[model samples]
Target: MVSPMITEKVISNAPYAASAVTVIAGFTVKDWGVIIGVVLTFITVIVNWVYKHRQDQRESALFNQKINHHQKHKNN
Candidate 1:
């Protein structure tokens, strides 16, 4: 999917950057429960990040639509 931030100045090559960062950051399999718990928490963070991002997007879209609709009738 095309990112919402790509422009003429910067490519915003995010998938490649994300994979590279994930690999370099060493977010991989672990041997112990404590280690796994840490990884799970990290995973939780990523999940929450994506969820909040999408939620914010939805909320903004709804708010914009509401304002547009309200203005359409209020201008009459």
Candidate 2:
């Protein structure tokens, strides 16, 4: 099923492939810096979300304990 013409074309273009690959793969310094910035921003958002979730859970537990204590005193 393979064509000889296509194989010959691929062999002819193979010599220039490295330069083409480098041009595609080469990221500038600014590109790397922006990528790092975006990653850090994502991590910071996740950490803040987890921290807030834990704080809310702790506050809810304390509130429940306070309500129970007050109700017991009122019943007596």
What is each predicted model's overall lDDT from 0 to 1? 0.82, 0.94
Judged by TM-score, which candidate is best?
2
Clashes of each: 0, 0
The total number of steric clashes, by the backbone 3 Å criterion, in model 1 comes to 0
lDDT of 1 at 12: 56
lDDT of 2 by residue, 1-76 (tens): 8799999998999979977888758988888799899999999999999999999999999999999999999999
- Tell how far residue 1 is off in model 1, in angstroms: 44
Would you estimate the TM-scores of all the predictions? 0.58, 0.68
